[model samples]
Target: MNATIILVGTELLSGMTIDTNSIYMAEELNKYGIEIKYKFTVGDNIKDIVEVIEFGKDKSDLVILSGGLG
Candidate 1:
């Protein structure tokens, strides 16, 4: 199945922190033969996050969201 990982954090976009989660997730998911089609980082903006989540859901069979859930 195809998957998309959405990393939510302004620090990620601002280059303040590296997004190791996506890298690790991609590598791990690859072992299961699940392809990660898209990866995105969005600031703590709800609208943008929702939009991206929706888009990812539409394009991928599975969507994994990390960080910024709080």
Candidate 2:
């Protein structure tokens, strides 16, 4: 399986907080034989999130998002 991970939140883009979720997820997915094609860091913008998801749609069989809600 191929996957893409989208990190949401302006803090990620601004470097306010360090993200470790992707690292863990990558390791877990790797063990399952899932190839991670792209890791996208997006600010707290709906348009940008959708755009990133759209881009990943063609490249990945699975798309995942992490970080900051509300």
TM-score of each: 0.94, 0.93
Error of 1 at 61 (Å): 0.4
To one decimal, what is the Cα RMSD in angstroms of model 1 from the true structure?
2.0
Q: For residues 1-70, could you state the per-residue lDDT of candidate 2 as single tens digits?
A: 8999999999887878888889999999999999999999999899999999999998899999997742
lDDT values, one for every candidate:
0.92, 0.91
lDDT of 1 by residue, 1-70 (tens): 9999999999888888887889899999999999999998999999999999999989999999999533
How far out, in Å, is residue 25 in model 2?
0.5
Clashing residue pairs, candidate 1? none
Candidate 1 deviant stretches above 4 angstroms: 68-70
Q: Model 2 off-target regions past 4 Å?
A: none
Evaluate model 2: give its TM-score.
0.93
